[model samples]
Structure formats: structure tokens, C-alpha cells
Target chain A: MAETAHAASREHFGSTSRRDSWWLAPGLVAAGLLLLGGYATWAALQGTHFEFGRYLSPLYSPKIAAPWWPLSPALLILIPPLLFRSTCYYYRKAYYRAFFLDPVACAVGELNRGKYTGETGFPFVLQNLHRFAFYLAFLWLFFLWHDVWDAFWFDGRFGVGLGTLVILASTGTLTLYTFSCHSFRHLVGGKLDCFSCTAAARGRHGAWLGVSALNEHHMGFAWISLVSVCFADFYVRLLSMGVFHDVRLL
Target chain B: MPEAVLHVYRGDASGGGLKEYRVPLEEGMVVLDAIHHIQGHQAPDLAVRWNCKAAKCGSCSAEVNGKPKLLCKTRMDALPPGQPVVVQPLKAFPIVKDLVTDVQWNYEVNKRIPPFTPKPNAEWRWKQEDVDRVQEFRKCIECFLCQDVCHVLRSHGRTDAFAGPRFLVRVAGLEMHPMDALNRTKFLKEDAGIGLCNITKCCTEVCPEDITITDNAIIPLKERVVDDHYDPVRMLVRLVTGKKKGE
Candidate 1:
């Protein structure tokens, strides 16, 4: 037998060849998530600047009624979107790879810590909550649209401002992200065996195709929506904090 | 004949690198044909594993230009003309030689799966609708391309815990089988680590068999696991009635 050098023996915790900076993506994701999470936590705890003249920060949408509750209202308001994001199919991959260093990237080595327990255990198993979260997330969209509707009316008169446009863009992108959910896609038409059978099924199949098209760019939606939400909150916070004046376009 | 540059990985277990070979491409040459040319003309000691020149046997699985594909099916014309097509072994498993990795782990995992068991003296008749769904899973040629592409195995090296998408499809075939009696839910949840799959659908994309792996096989199976293990009402019913929910 000829002495052949096997590539598997060169296996290590990461890639060998000196490629362009591979860590940049996961690094950015980690930093972005951290900034978002940290800001949300602080903003939630403050719980005061969530509402400005006509626009309510998404972090405090549906304005939890229980003011006397021990925790921040942001906690309650955040539940739907948080669960949605935490259980999001794309977000799970993003955070898992970015935060947990779960193999980091394709063809890259990962931390080999014996048999992988997967999501069978305590914390990881909670990811199954994503489907239930999808329900809450779907319902939450109504609240956001209502917020957008409220954004149009400044003190009961129909008008559009920079805040209105900002909120509109935020909700629009977030709607795209929410509709493009893997679970939502499945609910739309993924479970159907036949698309041509019956008018309703056909309609659903068409809807599914539309959602699937959006689902293709789900990762892009996830990131953009995240930024949009943060920006909306920041804009509202600026208005609320009196740091920046709301530019009236009407 | 047009010439194409092939950057084939030449070394083994200790260490190796990409060794370029120039091969004259025929009118309708596939990647495996070019590798054969390299073996015959330039490097007689070249180690390459192949079975059917047709795409049936699944033995010609390799990474062609950073994508998992069957060499016999990958047409040279489909690849870019200027760049050297990089051919390497599957990234998930241990490499035994050049292009072949030790895929025996998949076979072992197969052994652990309980064979299809029918209810005692039950009618063998099955609805075509049921057969149709399971038939999609049966279409798998066991190329292990799905396995190679799955990030859980390919990137994470979680072979011990997570059975890659290939076995999940196998499990889906058995679980969805109309006549099969035994429930594989426990095995799927605990042993196979079905929960690990976030359903990215990467496996479905790489499937030459065109199996909708994520939607059909993995998601449905994940739902089963949730129903069996996670549902509060189902848990209470199982505790009180002492009967499995789906059965």
C-alpha cells in the first residue's frame, strides 16, 4: 500500500489555511446581540422612557397593565419578541454559532467535549418554546401595527412625521422577519402534501410560496429588523428624553 | 479537448495539501472522469474512491469547489472554466484516505434503529397518501451529502449526540411508515438528539435526491418529540392513562 497522507489527521479546533478573517461575522453578531441585549435590559429596567408623544417603543408595546408587578413592564412586553427571537430558527443558528461557538462556521473545527448532549437538557431544551412563541409573536404584530396606526395620528389628527416614518419602516421590516419564520412557513403550507387540491389549500400554497420567498432572505431580515427595532427605540428614547426634538413633516 | 486544473488533496492522516493536476476535459466530462485521468496519466499512486460512474452508489461523494457533490454527477462545464476545481474529502467524518472518509459511524447508527415492526396479525394494507409521504424519505440514496452539509455534524462534530440529517430522514421513513408499529419517538428525542436541529434546511438544499429534509422529516419529527415529551396535557394523560399518546 502506498503511504498516503490523510487530511483527517490534520483536524484541529479550527481551519488550518490562512483565510481572510473568518471570526469577523460571528464577532459582529456577538457584539450586535450584546449591545441590543444590554440596551434592552437597561431600557426595560428604566421603564419610563418607553412612551413618547405618539410613538411607543417596541420594547414596551402592548403596555403591560400591571404597573405594581415586581418586574419591569418591559419584561412582559418583551416576552413575545424575546421568545420569538430566542426560538427563531435563523436566530438559533446565529446565536448558537456566534455565542456558543458551536462549530463557528462551515469546515471549521469545534470544541470537542465528548458526546454532544444537544438540546435534550435543561436550558437548551427550552428552545422548543419557539413554536409557542410563534403564536405570541403573531399576536404581537397586531399591537405593533396598532402602534404604527397611533404613530400616524399625533394628538388625534392624521399626520406623518419622521417618527411615523421611522416606526413604519421598523414595523415593516419586523413584519417581514416575523412572517418569514420557519414555524410560520410550516404553518402556512409546509405541512400540506398537495398544493393543487382544493381552493383553500391552493391559496395557502400560494401564501406559503410567498412566505418561502421571504424566508429565503430570513437572515437578512433578522439582522435588519433587529437594527430597525433598536433604532426605533433609540429615536423614541431621544424624543422622550428630550435629547432630540421630533421633526414634524406635516 | 479543453484542459482543466484540478486541485486535489493529496496527503493523509498525518498532514497533506492540495496538489494541482492538469487534465484534458472531454466534451461532456464529469469530475470523476478528470480524477481518473489524473490517476492514469500523472499520478498512478493517486487514491480516489468511486463505484458507479452513475450517481447511484453514493461512493463518489466529495467536496467539489467548496460544495458537497457526487463527482460522477458534477459536470465540468457547470463549474467555472478559469479556476482550479478543488476536490476534497467530506468534512464531517474521519478521512481514511484521499476522498473517502470513514462513514461507518452512519452504518452503526443505522444498526441502533429498530427495524419496522408490524402489529400482530394486522392488515398490511396502507393508504397511498401515507405511502406517498414516506416514499419521499425512501428516495434517499444514502449519499451522506445531507450528513456532510448538516452544521451540527459538519461544523460541531457532535456525532456522539446528534445523529445527522441522513439518519433523521431514515428515522422519518420508519416513523412515518403506515404499517410500522413501534414508536421511535423516545429514541429520536433522547438518543438521536432531534432537538439539536434548528431546521435551517441546509440539508434539503444539498440533497441530490431532492428530499425536503427539514420540512418533511426533521420538523414533523420535532413536532412529534414536542407532543410526546413537552405537551402538558399529553404528559398528564400519559401519567394517568399509562398509554402512549400517539399509539
Candidate 2:
């Protein structure tokens, strides 16, 4: 055991202190979000797009010329503050803790263990519900596709080329982010035995690199998760209506 | 501040009785301080094991009002207001004297698991992120609140089947760590009995550091175990490709 302990110390070089040139990840994300939001907003007023029924566009079939009429932009005003607070976690770790784990500030449904009945029925019953939540989260992977579909335009930007791909990248990233979550992994129910299983390729392939990356920006994920969904939905709505163009070359 | 009547369980394995005494309760007095007051002023023979008053040392653990907590951090005000505070020795470990219990068994349980074994020739400079992953686990003072509250060993008396939460957290911290490449999951399941934790989340509730034990540590490790052994497609891939997952 002593020999093995010494050996374990030698292999992985696991150092997780917060100080190893750590400013780069958040710094880059902050600059990128700023650039994206700034460009999108500036293009909104200058561009002839501010169509109200944009989300309702594709289903409108054989797309007609967009009506220039503006919807009540009151909801749009709330977007910036919400977006800023949400994406701020992407840039700062402390913000995540203050927002999510705060005793008073946390989401209402932590399923306090204090409520357990110790019976075979209730506690385990509630635990089984997580798998359903997993399915709900799994639907997000496709919702990004839905957002991509909604944002697609045959007439805009040489007939909708990279929008799907961009949304795919966003969705892939979001999937990586969500699957790395401790709760979702448990719901997938893989921890019943040895680590060398056959069907767990997705989980095992993703666990190490994914866990380490998310662990680094856990605070960011905690906050940005709430923000990204809102932003993605907004991006879809804004672009579909031609109110804003996510005009950028990646 | 009102004086508190501390009813200390003042016996050993031979079985003794509760001895009650009053101590002056200050605004920020911990249960340990009250114990100390009783020891110094009233019962010098009162036996209690303590070193660092800070919660880091893990030595001053006693069942405060029947809940396992590090004595130094438990504030007197947090106690139920009207009842006399009841203190007892740790129930799982055999009583050494009054408030101290023999925690040597925990160390023995720790020893049975093979130590950390990294991957081959894996000498690399430790990454800061990797260190951060294990840092919170490092925060464990080993107060054994998780162990004490663990129903497997405590209530159900599954001493032979379960390794309890404290050790599981220790093993998970070491195993999930990026730097430590040792595959200790087999040891955890067979010897440590990781399956006994039904995700009741009782251990997480008692942890003073607020570490997400059930969700973060235990459940994820459990998922990994399931994937490794139970996932048939992974095994077929490993068989066909002649590759191995981290062991």
C-alpha cells in the first residue's frame, strides 16, 4: 500500500491549486462575450432587421418580406442585465458561489435530506426522478438544434450556412458542460461496478478531461449555464426576426 | 450570557452514567469550551481528548447533543435553547474514557485500501487545476461526522459491509484526482462497500465545509464504477481496439 501510494503520487501530476497562470480562461471568455454582444447590438440598430414575429417566422412558410414593425421592446431592455449577470460567471469564479450556493440565494429545490422517510419507497422514489430530469436535460441537446432551425435563413448571409454549425458547436459545448455535472452522471447510473465497462465510452472518454476543465471553471459553469440558455434563446429570437445578426467570422 | 447545564456522559466501556454540571456560557462559546470549563473548574478528572481548538485537527470530536460534530466549531447559541446540552463519546468507536473514543479503527480502515498508484512513468509537474480538484477534499479535518452519521455503521450496524462515508470521501478524493492515477474503485466497491450509501445525503448535511458529498463525490464515483464494469459496449471496444481505460 505504501509502495502504491508513492506510485500514485508519481503518475498524474494532479495539481489543482487556483494559481497556475489561471487568468487566461476567464479573460478570453470575457473578451469574446463582449465582442459578440457589442457587435450584435450595434448591428441591430443599423441593420433593417427588428422584425417582431421572428420566432414565429419559419413556421410562417414560404417566407414573405419581414414586417418592419417593432414589438414592445420592454422585454428586450431586461436582456442586457440578465445576460451580463449570467455570463459574468463565465469570467469570474467568486460570482458563481455568491449566486448559486448562497443559502438565501440558492434555487428552492435542493431536496433537503431532512425530508427523508428511511422507508424503501420514498427516498429511492425521489432518486429515480433524477433520470427523468436527465431526459429533460438530454432534450437540451436537441433544443439547440431547434434554436438552429429557428435561426436558419435561406435569404440571409448567402442562405444560412454556418448557423447550424455554430449552434452545433454551442450545443456540443453545452452537452460537455452538462454531462460533466455530478448529478447527471449519477442519473446515467454507471457506478455499479468496476471502471472497465463496455457501454460507458461516452462517460469514460469525457470524465477526465471534461471533469478537470469544468472543475476549473465550475463557478463559471454554475453561472453561465443559466445565462447561456437565455442568450441562445434570445440569439435565436433576435436573428430569426432579423432584429440582430450574430454577424461574426469565427 | 446564561450559564449552561452541561450533562456530560461520564463513563467508559464499563458503562457509567451522566454527570451534570453548570458552566458559564459566553456569546461565542463552543461545546468544547464548555467541556473545558467543566474540566478545569469542576471536574479535573473529566477525560476528553482535544488538541487544536480549530476544527482542523479533528481530535475534539464528541457527540454534541447526540449529533457528531467537531467541538471547537459548534456554537452554543446553535443548541436548542431550553434543554441542557447533552454530550457523549463517539458511539461507533469504543469509549476510551469520558468524551474521547478510540478512532484507531478509522485509520485501520484507511490502511486496507491500496495507496495511490499513478500511471506508468507519469512524472510531470503538477498542474494547478489538478491540485485544486483535491484541495477541498484535503479540507477534511477527519472529524468523522460523516462516519458517525453514516447509518450503515451507526444505525444499521453494517460494520462488515460498509466502509462508511468519511473513508469513501477520502478514497473518492484520491481516486478522482487527476494527479493520482491509481484505480482504487475495485477496492472501494469490494472492500469499502461503496454501494451501501443510498444517496440519503445525510453525510452532506452534517459536513461543516458544506462539501457536496452525495452529489459530487459519491454519486459520480458510483457512475464511473457502473460504466467501467457494467457497460458492455465499452468492454467490446476495449477488446477490439486493444486499448485500456484508466485503471
Candidate 3:
């Protein structure tokens, strides 16, 4: 074989022979993650202004009514959903490249060289908790949907408001994100060695195909849900702060 | 007659650079056709590896204008007009000559992966969905465009540690096989270095077969690895039930 380690081919950080604008993707991802992440952190810090007459911020959904807890209510309920997003297979790829600059784009040089440990070591090994987080996120969806249900009940009567739509969008996207999770897909169809071996396996095979189709768009759902969750919170916050009246669409 | 300028790389591991040639353009001429024109009319010694011009054989893999692509699939007219079309060897491998790199490393990686081993007295039956699931991975042509685009091999030069997306797809086919009994998760975790793939998905982007390499193969394989190596809950369940890992 011709020599494997050709010295000229090894590129330094952010360097490559690639001619296209390679930085555009990782740059945009970083900016978006930071912006949204910042907003989530800020919103979580404020315990007040998270609820509007009938609607509740998704960030504070299934609202923890424990007055004994000293911090923002959002902080207590946000951990599992936060862990879900953090350890997500798609987000790991996105943030690893975008935030860590671990080859910010494919074939692009990165800050770390041969010293890479990937997810095999400390801290990153925690990423394996993704499935556990997936379960939590899946269960968390019920509370969000309940909040959406609440958003429709105004003045003890059923009525649709813009806040209802906003909360619904948040819950809907979160549901898509949860159902389309890589771990969920694997649990549904991927674990089986023989789909034809059993009737249940055959059923799982069908479910797997559906989840596989959804998994293809998991990254899109991840981004859209991120934005939708924040937007829902912001909308509710505005209403609760009396900055705007809830526009009834009933 | 309209002609296109081609800057084909010409040299070996010691070093080399792109050599320009002009070829007459045809209605549907591909990059491989232009290279053939250069070989026949201009430079007979201009070495290039190609088996089938149909793009299915995958022997015509190279970087065209800094993009990993099959030369047979990339049409001449599809590229930017009036600019030199550059063809070079795959960056991840060692150069043997002009536009031909040592892809032997890929074959070596393939040999390391255990092939499908069926269970004892296992039923041969499997559903269409199982076929459909593994079939996507079976479509890989071994072009190594995925390997060429993979940063672990191309940039990090961690061929010692990482098995690129191509083999991951290969393993996915075997691992997901209905009757296969082999537990290759140990090989995946320790040797294949499945952890190294961050899954930015350029392999999926450059694939001519349109294989969902990242989403279908790598991620699922990684999830399996998690089941074996990382999931303490699964481990505890196995312990409580007195069941083996794969069972």
C-alpha cells in the first residue's frame, strides 16, 4: 500500500482544501444554539410571567407548585427536557461540530487533533443517558399536551386563543421531536434480530419503518421544536406580563 | 467545437500537482469521459482507475472541484462553465498516482468486521420490513466517498481508531440481519471506534446511492453500542432477570 500518513494531507484547525464556504453551516448552528439556549436560560430564571389566563409556558409546563422550592419553578421541571435535548443524537452531532469545532464541517480541520476521545470517556459517557432522557421527554409530552388543553379553557368555557395555538405548536413540535428520537426508533424496531419471528416483532417492524421515516427529519424537528418551545414561552410571558391581551380566535 | 479544460492531478506519494488538458465536449459527456479523452488523445500515461462508467462499480471515485464524487455520475455540463474542472485523488488515502489513491485500507477495515453468523437452528424467515431496513445499507457501492468525506480519516488521520461510515453501513447490514447471532458490539466499541464518528453526515451527503448512512446505519449502530456498553438500566434489568446481554 502507498504510505498512509501523507504529511501534506493533515490540515490545521479550520483549514481544508475544500473551496466552498464550509463555515456557513456550523456558524449558523452555533449562533442559533447560543441564541435559543440563552433565551431558555433567561426564561427559566424568571419564575413570574410564565402563565397567561389559560395558557402556560412550555418551559414551565406541569408547573411545579411547590412553594418550598427556593428557585424558579421552570428550573425544577426543565431538567429532564433539558437533558433530552442535550444528549439527543442529532444535537450531539450539531453542537459537537458547531460549538466544539470538532471538525466544524466534514473533512474540515478541527481544534483537537489525535487527542480525540469522542463519547467513550468521562462526561461524554453520560450521553448514554439519552435513552433515559428520551423516556422522560416522552412522558413530559403528556404534561405539555395538558397545558395545551388548559390553553383552550378560558373563563371556565372552551375557547381558542392565539396563546392556545402557540402552546399547541410547542407541544406538537415537542411530540414530533420525542417520537422521532433515535433511541425511540431503536427501541421500536431496531433491537429485534428477527422481525418475522413473532407477531409482536412484525408489529414493531411496521412501527420501526414509521419511526425510521420520522428519524430522517429528526434534525429538522430538533431545530423547529427548539424555536417553537421558546416562542411559546415568550408568547405566554408577554400575555402574563399584561404587555398584550390574549387574542381570542374562537 | 466547444471544449472543457481539465486539471487532472498527476503524481504519487512523493508529490505532484494538477496537469491541464483540453477535451472536446459532447452532449452528455461525464468527467470520466473527459478523462478518457485526455488518456486517448492527449496523455496516454495519465493513470486513472475506472472499471464501469455506469457509476455503480464505484471505481471512478475522486474529488472533483474539492467535492467527493463519482466521476462517471458528475456530468461535464453540470459543473461551472468556463472554469477548469479539477480532478484529484481521494484525500483520505495515500496517492498511488494521478487520481488513484491506495484504497486498500478500506478493504483492510472491511476484513476486521465479522460477517453475518446465523443462530443455531435459526429460522430463515424474515419480514419485508427487515429486508427494507437492511437493504438501504446493502446499497453501498464501496466508493469510499463516505470515507473520503469522513473527517476522522480525512482530517484527523485516525484510520487507526475510527471505522468510517462505509464500514458502519456494512456492520449495520449484518447487525440488523434477522437471524444473525453474532454480538459484534464489542468489536464496534473497542476496535471500530464507533464513538469517533460525530455524525456530521457528509458521508450521507456525498453518497451516490442515496443511502441514509448517518441516520439509518451509524446512529442505530451507535444506539446498539449504547445498549451493550452504556445503558446501566438495561444492564440492571439483565442482572435482575438473569438474562444474557443479547438475549
Candidate 4:
């Protein structure tokens, strides 16, 4: 109250709630996503669609395989948003409004203010596991790009060639933009001052600055990432199902 | 064509109930207009704080029914009229009268954060990209809606621990810039309690300027905290190399 306009204590101003209900409209949407994911998984197993069988094959290697992989655990984007809510005034209010109140209207999980419920984990806690998830997603993306590469060109069989480089570049740029995020960067020790002074650190910072510049408009990336991930999954699914083609241009 | 019910929280900290006031409806009118009409006609002593009614200054933030919004920009017509429109003070800060809460918590938090520290070793020229990193935070209007609604500040009152989202963004602007030499990671982890934030993302939802407060600021700060405190390997590597990050 010393710095505030009102005489009210911090206690006087409190959030209604911010936990979103993963039911009703949001739940239905999530269910649809689950169904699509399930179908994609199934299609990959069957090898009827894109390579119905090969996509499910453990023998196949993705574009960015484990050996020289650039993808790390820091790529998770959810952590920042989650961490932000814990410290934000608006998020506290919205958190309660969305999840605690009508729960059904909310698309995500709930919170107990500062409590990190370990046993019956809430959606808010999913942010912590983001680093690992991002690693898997990034790995998959690299593989998909590799698959696109294998599918391109004239000496062409079922695989590709030169034009396939474009897919690799597109995915690479998207991953760079996503991974270079303030959130992901933070996850990877980006806020570390030493990195700025080190050899590749400065240049990486330069690359980060380039990406972060694009990232500063993160709400843009948030939307585009959402769209890209969905589109990428759709492409994979279509190819898996044989319902669509990769259209090799060599 | 219809009348709207204004559900006002009546009473001081002593205790208050919601008082209902009926207002005539019109097109293109904002919630602020109705509050003003009610104040002028029925309750002259009704306490509310606002300025720059154009929504440029973030003074008039309040819960419209339940959402955090600048009353000036919230069109009454956009809200669902079937239920009572509940207008309440911002939740994170203390209430002065009605819709106004003490926003000074923000200014104080801002003070605790490290100021922009430019490295003294070299020329001051900066990349336009570096400048862009922190500039997004400048769009903040100090509505404190983000501060008022934050659970750490509101529910826990950990003012001594956390700096809240508003200050986090303020700090991010200064800390992330390539031109800034002052390492704020220590302050972020220790003084500011960056690890305390759980990334619930409630701030991103209510930001009027649409700044991704959680994704852009808190996450990065948390990452910094992890590098400083949780990640042992990175620390050893940095120590061996004689380079300290967020120092």
C-alpha cells in the first residue's frame, strides 16, 4: 500500500481464479486432437498411407538424428507461459476465472496459486516437462525434414532430392525461430551472462538476437508455431495415409 | 432496448455486498460510461480511479464481470448481457475506493530490479536487434492489471521474494539486450525469486498491449535462474572457463 494509489493491502486485491477447465468446448477440441493423433499413430503403424509401414519402422532415421542433433531439452515453449502466470497479476485472475469458475470453458488446467501439486499434477505443471517434450518434437521435425529430403528429385524413386533441401531449410528456420525463443533460450541458460562473453557465445547471441528479434513478437510465433506444428502433423498423416502426396520436385 | 444491471461491490474492508444499479443501455458505450452514470446520478461518493479514458494510460483496469480489461476500452455491447456485469477492483493490489487499487507496488518492484548496466569496456553502439529485445516491454502502460492479478503477489504476498510480471518484463528489456553488460541473473534468481514463477500464463491472457509476458519474460528469467541455481554442469563449465552468465 505504500506505493499504491489505494489504501488496500495486497490481501484486499485478490484473484478470483485462473485454472482453466479441460472440459466442454476446450475438452471437445482436445479430444478431437487426440483422435487425430491416434489416427496418425495408427496410420504410421499400418504403413498404408505415406509409407504407412516405414513411418512406424524403428529402422528409419529422421533428418536430425541423435548423433549430431541440434535439438535440446530447452525447446519447450510452455515453461515460460507457465512461469509467467505464477508471477503475473493478470494471469492470476484469468487462471481462476478460466479453470476454477466454469472449468468447462477453460482449455487447460488449474492452479492453487503458488502450490506445485506433485501428486495430482495440474496442467500448469506440464510446463516443467516441456524441455523433454520439445526435444522429442524437435527430433521428430528433423526426421520429417530428412524424410522430405529423401522424397525429393529426379534420380527419384519413392524418395526425393535437391528440392528436398527446401523442406530442411523451412523446418530448420522454424525450429531456429522456435528454439531461439526467449522461453527456450531461458531454458537453455540464455540469461547466463558468461555465454555473451564466450567464443561462439557472442555469435550464438547474435543468432539469438536475430531470432529473439523475431521472437520478441512471440505472440506471432505462438500462433505460427501452433499452425506449423498442426500443419506438419497433417502432412505427416496425409503422407502416412497415402491420402496425399509429397509432390517431389527435382 | 434493454437495461443492464451493474453489480458493484459495496462496502469497505469492513465488509461489503454486491449492490445492483440499473442503467439504460445504448450502442457504442463502454463500461466506464455506465459507472460514471451511476456515480453521477446515484452515488457521488463512489470511489473509482481512472485517467486518459482513451485506454492509452493503463489506469482503469478492473474485472469486467470476470475478465481483466481496461474499462475504457471494454464495450458494454461486447459482453454477455444475460447475466449481471460484475465490476470489481484489480485483485493483486490493495483497493483505494472501488475499482482503483494501489498500483505503486509496481513502481517499488521496478526499483528493486537492476537498472540497465551498459558494459564499460567498449563503445556503446548496439545492434538494432538487441534494442528490439527489450523494446517490447516498453509498450507496457503500467495498468498493474498484470501485477494486480498475479498470484505470487496477490495470494502469497511474497513481495520480498518475487518481483511480479511487470518488473520481470522491465528487467528482461534491460538484461537481454546485447549492449547491457550488467548481469542481472543474480538479482533475478536471488533478490527477485525468479524460480517462484510457475508459468501459469495468466498474465499473457490479460495483457492489453498483447505482450507475451509469460512466454517472453518470465520463462527467460526462469531459464536464467535454472542456469544459475539448478544446472550444475553449466556452472562448472562456466567456472572452469572463467565466464559467468547473468552475473
Say which candidate scores most in TM-score. 3
lDDT (C-alpha) at residue B109 in model 2: 79
Ranking by lDDT: 3, 1, 4, 2
Q: Which tens-of-lDDT digit does each residue in B1-247 have in candidate 1?
A: 6789999988766667789999997989999999999999999888878998888888889888767889999999998778888999887777877777878788877887878887789766654544676798988889898888777777655676777799899988887676677778889887888887766566886788888887668877876777678867668988999987564
TM-score of chain B of each: 0.96, 0.92, 0.97, 0.92
DockQ of 4: 0.25
Query: By the TM-score metric, which is better: model 3 or model 4?
Result: 3
Q: After superposition, how far is residue A109 of candidate 3 from its true place, in Å?
A: 2.8
| Model 3 bad stretches (over 4 Å) | A1-8, A66-69, A112-114
Task: Note the Cα lDDT for every prediction shown.
Answer: 0.79, 0.55, 0.86, 0.58
**lDDT (10s digit) by residue, model 2, range A71-105:** 33323432433333332212222332222211111
Ranking by TM-score: 3, 1, 4, 2
Sort candidate 1 into its docking category. incorrect
Evaluate model 4: give its lDDT: 0.58
Supply DockQ values for each candidate. 0.18, 0.05, 0.51, 0.25
Query: What's each prediction's TM-score?
Result: 0.77, 0.56, 0.95, 0.67
lDDT of 2 by residue, B1-247 (tens): 5888888988777777688999888988999999999889999999998898988788888777656778898898988777788887766666768987777667777878777767578665554534554566777778877776665455444556566777777887777665566676577666776755565455786787777676567766665654455446567888898877533
Tens digits of per-residue lDDT for model 4 on A83-155?
4423233333233343343122311122333542211145543344444444554555555565554545335
Winner on lDDT (2 vs 4): 4
